[model samples]
Target: MSQTTQPLHFARQPHPSPVAPEQRAELLRNPGFGRVFTDHMATIRYTEGKGWHDAKIEPRGPIPMDPAAAVLHYAQEIFEGLKAYRTADGGATLFRPEENARRFQKSAERLAMPILPEALFLEALDQVVSIDRDWIPEGDGSLYLRPFMFANEAFLGVRPSSEYLFIVIASSVGAYFKTQADAVSVWVSENYTRAAPGGTGAAKCGGNYAASLVAQAEASRNGCDQVVFLDAVERRWIEELGGMNVFFLFEDGSMTTPPLGGTILPGITRASVLALAKDKGITVREEPYSLDQWRADAASGRLREAFACGTAAVLTPIGTVKGRDGEFTIGNGRSGARTEELRNTLVDIQRGRAADPHSWVHKVF
Candidate 1:
C-alpha cells in the first residue's frame, strides 16, 4: 500500500434530510443484513494526472454515472467487506481495517487500477463510521462496511479507465443467515467452478462474484445453504465455498484448508482462525484435499468436523455435504466442540469482549 505525502482531508456534508432518531432506532432494531443503510457514506475520486482527491463524507445516495462508463462495459470493480461493532461502553470499533486496505490495494493492482494509499482508504472508513455511530447496533450486532472502487471514466475503449471512484457505505446488520443457525449444508458444485488458474479469483472483484452467482443458485436449488467449488482443472480438489473459506478438523486434532496458491481468496478470517488454532496447540495445514478424500475421511471418522469462515459468516459449521452422487454428514451434523471454541475465541477478540494479544481491533469511535 502506498503512502500519501499529505494526509487527505475529508469534507463533511451533512444529510439534508437525515433519518429521525425514532425511525433510525426502529431500523436499527431489525436492520437485517444489507437491508438498511446508514445515513451517510464516504467517497474519494481519482484521475490519471491528479491522484486521489475530492474526499467527502456525504449523504448516502446514488452516484450519477455515464452510460459509456468503462465499468459499464468492462466491469472494472473491486470491493471489501468489514464491520464496525459497538463496544460495551457504546463505542464503535473496527476489526483489522488496515488489513482490508492492504487487500484492497492488491485487488486494485490485479485489476490494473491505481492504488489508493492505505491511510486514505482507512480515513474514509473512519469518516463513515464516526459520523454514523448511531447506526451501530447493540449486543452481537454490527454496522457492515462496504468499500468499493469502480472505473468511472466515460470511455468505451478496451484499455483501463483513466478515472475511478472509491466509496464506503455502511449497513446496520443483525446476521447474514436468517435462521442464524450454527450449522449449514453445502452442495458440491459439479458443473460450475469459481475461478481458473491465473484468474481474478484471488482479487476481491465483482467479476469473480458475478461468475459464482450461477453456482450459488445451483446450490440453493440443491436444497443447500452454499456451494462448494472444486479446482477448475481437476474438478475434484476442494477449493472453497461460495464467498467463504472451508476448513477440516481431523480426529488427530489437525486442521486443514486449501492452500492459497492462486485460485482461492486469502481470507482474513481464515488466516486469523489458523493463528488462533495454533495458539491452542492445534496443527494447521494448507495442503490440497480432494473431494474423494474429504468424503472418505468423514465416513471413516477421521475427519470430525468442517466449517466455513468469512466476514459475513464468521464461522458456520458444515453439518452436511451433498453432490450429484450422494450426501454425507460431518460429526453428528451439529456444531462441533473445537469449531465452537475457535469461533468464540475469534469473535470475542473481534467484539472487544476478550483480550486481544494481536491488537487486531481498531476502535473507530
Candidate 2:
C-alpha cells in the first residue's frame, strides 16, 4: 500500500444546530465516558481504486447502512481512542495521536480493510478537535477522540468490502475511575479466553471487545470491577485484563508485563509507562508471569503492586484478584508508591505540567 506524503485538505461543513454554550457547559460538568458527544464529526470515504476521498467535517448523527452491509455480516471494523487535554496555558493538545494512527493502520491491515493514510488520520483528528475545542472540559476532564473505520459496502459474501467509511468524533469525558486512589478488584475468567495464538487479539477492533463482553459481565456478577484472562492454551499464564494491559511491580524495584507476541494489544499508555520506568532507572521486564506466581508472590510479599493500563483507564491499581481457585489481595490491597508515582508522572506530562522530554504531546491550538 502506497502512503500519501502530503496532508489531505479536509472540507469544512459546520453544524447549523450546535449545542448552546449554557447546555454544553452543563453537560461538560460531569461528562461520563462516551456519553455526550460534540456537535460535528469528521468523515472520509474510500473506494478500492479511487483511494480515500470526500473528506469533510459534518454534523453528528446516525449513519445510513444496508441491512446486509459487509460490516453487519463480516464485521470488518477498526477503531482508535485517545484524548485531547486542556493544557495549563489555556490551549488544547493531543497525547500521542500519531501512535494511535499507526495502530489504526495495523488494525486495518489485519482486518483486510484499506489503511487510511496516516496524514489523513491526523488531519481528521485535528479538524475535529479544532472545531470542538470548546467541548474539551476544564480541570482533570478531557475531550476523548474516537477514530474508526468500517466496511460500508452493501453487498457482502464472506469477503472484504470494496468501500469503507472512516470517521472521527469527539466526546467530553471525566476520569475512568471516580478518584485516582480508588483501586479496583479483578476476577479471573477461567471459562472464557480473550485471544488465541493467531487471532485478532493485537488489533484494536470492535470484535475483540465484543468477545470480551461476556467475561466482563461475569466479572460484574462476581462482584469485581474487571475480568482478567489467561492464555487460551494453558490457562495459567496471564495475558491481560478485559480491555487493559496488566503490569506487576516486584519488591526488588523491578517490573514485568507479558510480552507482546500476537495475543496482546500494544497499548500507548503501557509503552509510555515502560519508557518512564526505564528512564527512572527501574528494571523493567517483558516476560510472561503466570497466575500461580502472581498469587504466590502476593502471599509471600514478593509482589509490591499490580495495575492495568489503557487509553480509557490510564493507570488503575489492581487490589484484589479473584477466581475459582480463591481470592487474594495484592500488597495490603492498596495502591503502592511506585504505581502512584508512575501514574502521576504520566498524567503530569499529559496535562503539560511536566516537561515533555520525548515530545509525546501534540499541541493543536
Candidate 3:
C-alpha cells in the first residue's frame, strides 16, 4: 500500500437486519450499480476545538441530524469514489486511493471545511473494507467505496460549520455500463454550465452535479447517454461531461484535454490516463479544446477518437457529439481502436493483469 501507516480504531456494530444470503445472492446476480449496500459503515465526528474524534464502524443506517443541518441548507459537503478490486489470489486491493484522499481534502478546503487528515481518511477506508471484505464482489464486479464529509451543524447561519461528520460506505457495483462495447452518445449543452470562473466546478460537491441535471435530462431526451458542458465564460471551450472529464484524440498521434483552470475537477482517472499515454510514448496536451476544433477535426478525419474518464466509468468512448447547429459522428458510431487500447491498458493495470510501472494500484490486504 502506498499510504502512511495510520492506526485505525474501530467500534464494531452488529447489523440488526443484514440482508439474508438468498437476497444478497439475487442482487449479486445483477447488481446493476450503487443500489444496494453492505451491512456496516465507518464514521468519525469532528468539532471546532476537538478536531476529529469518536471514530467508529457502525451499522448501515441513518445519522440523526437537526432539520437545519448545515449540509441540508448551505450544502457544505464533499465526497470521493474509488473501488476495491477482488484479486485473483482472493485478496482485495484499492486503486490509487491516496490520490482520492488528497482530492477530498482539496474539496473540503474549497468548501471552507476542516480538512480531514490523510491518516483519518485512510483509516476509515481500511476499517470499512476490512469489516465488510466479503462484500467485495468477484469476477468483474467490485465493492464501490464512497467516502464523504458534510457539515452537521444545525445553526441557520452559514459562514462555515463548526461541527462536521465524515463517513465511508461501501456498495456492490456490477458495471457502469451494461455492455462495455456500447459507444456512448453525448448531447452538447449550450446553455447550462457546470462550473464558472472562481466557482466550485473543481470541487466534487453536490451543487456542481445538481446544476448539471437539467442538461443531463436534455441529453436523455435526445437519446444521448450523457451531456457535455462548456465553460461559463466563453461557452466555446469544452469543459467536461455531467459526471466525467473529456478527452480528444488528434490525427498527429497526440491527445488533448481541457486544462484544469480551477474550473474542472482533476479526476484521478484522468491523471492516470495521461501517465499511461506518456508510457506508450504518445504525446498528450492539457490545453483548452473547443467544439469548433473537434468538429473541424472530425470533418477532416484528424480527430480519430474521443472519450470520457472517471472513477465510475473508467473510460467511455464518445460515439457522437450533438449540438444545436448539427451533430458530428466519430469512428462509424462505435468505439475506436485508440479508445479501446487506452481502456485496456487502464483495466490491465487495475486488475493486476499488467505490471503497474507507475505503482498506481494499492493492496488492501
TM-score ranking, best first: 1, 2, 3
Error of 2 at 300 (Å): 0.5
Which digits, one per residue and each the tens of the lDDT, describe model 2 over residues 172-234? 999776445468999999999999999999999999999999999999999898999999999
Where does candidate 3 stray beyond 4 Å?
1-8, 178-181
Error of 3 at 199 (Å): 0.7
* lDDT by residue for model 1 (1-365), tens: 23356778899999999999999999888788899999999999888877788899999999999999999999999999999999988888899999899999999999999898888988899999999999999888899999999999998799988999999999999878765556899999989999999999899999999999998999889889999999999999999998999999999999999999789999999989998998999999999999999999989999999999999999989999999999999989899999999999999999899999989999887
lDDT of 3: 0.87
Clashing pairs in 3: none
Please give the range of 10 consecutive residues that has the lowest summed lDDT in model 1: 1-10
User: Could you estimate the TM-score for every candidate?
Assistant: 0.98, 0.98, 0.96
**What are the lDDT scores of the predictions, listed in order?**
0.92, 0.92, 0.87
RMSD of 3: 2.7
